[model samples]
Target: MSRSVSRGVVALLLSCALLLTTGACGGGDDKTSASAAEAPTASASFEQQKLAKTRFVANAGLAAGATYQWIVKPYRAGKFKKGADGRTFALVKAGLAGAFTYNRLKAAVNNAKGDPLLSKAVAPLSAGIESLKDLGTKLRKGEAGDADVGAFENIINSVKDAGKSAGAEVVDKVPSASQLGGG
Candidate 1:
């Protein structure tokens, strides 16, 4: 071979070796690298947190009755299993409640019409949503225990506290008979 051709062959071999070692240029197993690259982004941004908090409060006000319906009614109706070992129903109920709350918050966040406070609330709410999602996954997998429940409760509490901190008041207070009667 000519000297130039020989040098070009050597360069090509070196390039292939580098790609193989670095798992780039398609020379190494792509599955592992692709999965690593494809891992879902889990970090919540500031705007997400703001939106989460705002939506949480709005849902708490707008859907408080629904929350009670889904989480409390079944247990009261005895449709849920009884006994300490039968905590699955309770966990599932709580998970559903959390999921609803998170969904509402996410929607509100996504629908914000450029509100600054809503933007600021998104990150924390996003983190809370991530926690709630993990809790829901655990409940679905039958892997939630007392500790998981406690953690989930804490997350919900934090969301509430964040809402209060953001100056959002509870707008769903019980109305007395006089108020109901338009007195």
Candidate 2:
């Protein structure tokens, strides 16, 4: 199959993995096994895959945005920090570090290159890592710039919009900027 299709398929499969914490799929309590007749086993459609990709990315985006804002809040008032708060920064950083090690995010980025909308939003989502890397560098230098902060906010908004475009599935999981501790 084409690369985009493969990516979409991967995205759908990984949805369960992405939401493992929330017990979204089979891992949760399976209290009911009343129906023996299973649905058709056909693969997810292109649209379905796209929706899954959008949902995963959007949730991830909002989480990243919240992390960025959490880390940068001390510096949001036009004041660069000598050092970011260890606990708050660690909250986001540790999670990001874990995601980088995930096959899901990596596969979606590598395989979804042909999907225009998914690909478009993926760039900003990927750039979030770069922003975090910059944060690491800034930590060494003992200061942060407005540009990094602005870029992260833009990335967050892009993620929010992309998720919203997927309809309720994605939008429902995304937190507002204020909910993310906006200034």
Candidate 3:
């Protein structure tokens, strides 16, 4: 191949590779490279990131409620059993995972200072997380009653409304009180 054409092709390939892989091009300066980890959050400006984090928090709040529903649907019929032990264990594990995600998301919401509307939703979501943890503990101890289930469901429903107020579609699949098995 001609030298000019070969160099052009090499440059094209290098640019494409750099674009696809992050931190690919510039690695000369130590100070700038150290700040690169914050690059994504920096690109949109902190205000934009605060708004995006608020939306992310709303979605995560809804997901935390959904996780409880995911584990509780099977247990609507009876208590924890020997065969159900694995499922119960899995549910509790999932609940803990949801807790971690929710707590982090909540922290993000708290840190989102630019948007004042997002702050209003924090309380119900916090209550929902507390109830979720309580439900997991009750289920683990084999002391979960219909009342406990009802309370968890109620807290999740309240959080769904709170999320909507915070500008998220959280109640898309949530049932009415009658559809919640009316215990």
Q: Which candidate gets the maximum TM-score versus the true structure?
A: 3
Instruction: Spell out the clash pairs found in candidate 2.
Output: none
Greater-lDDT candidate between 1 and 2: 1
Query: lDDT at 78 for candidate 2?
Result: 30
15-93: candidate 1 lDDT, tens digit per residue: 3343233212112223433343344554434444444445445544432332344334444444344454434444444
Worst 10 residues of 1 by lDDT: 173-182
Model 2: runs farther than 4 Å from truth?
1-41, 46-51, 54-62, 77-80, 83-133, 166-183
Ranking, lDDT, top scorer first: 3, 1, 2
lDDT of each: 0.44, 0.41, 0.45
Worst ten-residue run, lDDT, model 3? 174-183
lDDT of 3 by residue, 31-124 (tens): 3333543567755455554554454454445444444554456456443444564444444433332333334334434433334555566554
- Taking every candidate in turn, the Cα RMSD to the unseen true structure, in Å, is 22.7, 15.2, 17.9
